[model samples]
Target: MIRSIIKNQECFSIVQGLPEPGQDHNLVWLEVHTPTVEEGTILQQRFGIETAKKNSNVVEDGQFLYMRSRLLALDDNGAPHFGGVTFALGEQLVAIICDDANFQSFDIALQRLRRKPANGQSPKAIMRSLLQIANDRADELVDQIAEELEKRAEDISEISDGYNANGMELGVPDLIETMRALNAKEELIALCIETQLSLARTVRYLSSEIDSTNEADLQGLVNELAFDVAGVKEHAYFEHQKVQYLQKSVTNILNIKQNQIVKVFTIITAVFLPPTLVGTFYGMNFAVMPELSWEHGFVYSMGLTLSAAVLPLIYIKRKGWLR
Candidate 1:
């Protein structure tokens, strides 16, 4: 689908399809979302812009500045997905190309663009707004992931406290689920970081390409956008570090729990080993054994085996290991 936003004086109007060559509106915006074969052909024939490409970058092509960026979107389940977005910036118009899945990602930019004054409605201004929007979204996502990691840290603390205070065990399955969630958040943070960096680079390039004297205000906007997006990238990196810290904390907690369980089992085995040895000696079928001839031999052997087990327990208790 193709939609056009035309600015006439102080008002902006949305129309279907691209603006005519000699149209009334001087400033135009062509949005090609989920374009069909014929629409792509029209874009190629009219604007000479193609969407078939990979990677994110900015380049100058004759009378237009072409930029391809990877935009991040969230699914219904809040999982992050990246899609390609191509922008063709002409003197008075900008054509944005994106897939249907990422079509709504431009809503914020479009809404904010409508609120700008007539002088601020240029293609370069709109491009700056789009980058700024992406940076803002990245900031929000990073903040959210950080909050989640904080909660997960609290959960680890609770599990640790329960285990130390009351011998309550944390289930392996639960630990695994938490780790999986942290891993997913880590992936999301990485995407946010990458997207922010790309946006910042694009803004910096745009600022450099602009004729500073001709459009001083627009250049300033792009430069400020570069700084903002760079800040957001740093924020994402910090959150990524937090994610790693949480992952290590979870691992340590699980390891400690497992070691404690193994320790208890080792103590149990040690306590019972001497009794097993005593029983094995008395049960041997030796007809000439002196203990078999004595009437009280069976009782004495039982007492000795019981004493062997009790002695180990007493020694362990004194060593403070039982606590």
Candidate 2:
């Protein structure tokens, strides 16, 4: 859908489709979501907007592309790719171009600000407002990721302490899977931080190219956006550290548990070795073996087997290996 928001005569109004060429001078913003070639043509013919190829957000053809920050989405084969809003920032015109569904918050913000006086009435200000919404969305994603990470940390702690979510002892496989899932959350938070940083940089670049007079009124919004981006970047970094720690702790716990199992198996094998040797030695008796010929030879052989097993038990117990 193609949506345009224009600041005309000190008022912010939402228009359903493309504006006619030369009809309005204060048309500050034009948004296209999943537009086809035909829709792209409308903007190109009317406003000299460039139709970018390959759904790419990278700046091309003398048009400055501002990629909307988005969560990471892996494709069918699990490769990370961008799937969010992208706007081309240009002189006297800001195009909200997106092939992503998650870019709707900007529209909601525009609605909230529509009735408010467009006192600034500048394209740069409109651009800043849209960017602010994107940042707000980023903040919300960060908070959500943080909450999920907190819960996952608690779960990992519980498993390390030998308890499950239901207070039962958790198995090794479950713990490993839980820690692995956290990798995806960290990935998501990282994407959000990148989004925040990208938005800040794009806005700065746009601000820089404009004449000082055109950008004078947008300085405050731009500064606030930079601060927000910085704060989010710091928070994302801290959260990323927490995820790493959780992964390490979970791995250590898995290794310890595995080592404990190995120790038990090693002790079992040690204790059984002597008994098996005794049984094998008797099994190899010759036809003229005296002990096999004796009447009480079976009892003697049984006693020897018991003694062989008991000696290793005594030895291992004295060395404090039982526990």
Clashing pairs in 1: none
- lDDT by residue (144-245, candidate 1, tens digit) is 788888888877776766542356665656677888999998888888887887777677767866889998888887877777888888889999999999
- Return the TM-score for candidate 2, rounded to 2 decimals: 0.81
TM-score of each: 0.89, 0.81
lDDT of 1: 0.77
lDDT of 2 by residue, 1-323 (tens): 88777776766777888766664576777878777889778777777676554454455457554544443333445334455656677667777767664435565557656655552355666677776766666666677778888898888878878876677878698777887798887787677667766777766765565566646656766777778867877887888888888888888888988988998999888878998999998888577778877899999989988898899889999999877
Model 2: lDDT to the true structure: 0.71
Pick by lDDT: which candidate is best?
A: 1
- Residue 85's lDDT within candidate 2 is 58
Against the true structure, candidate 1 reaches a TM-score of 0.89
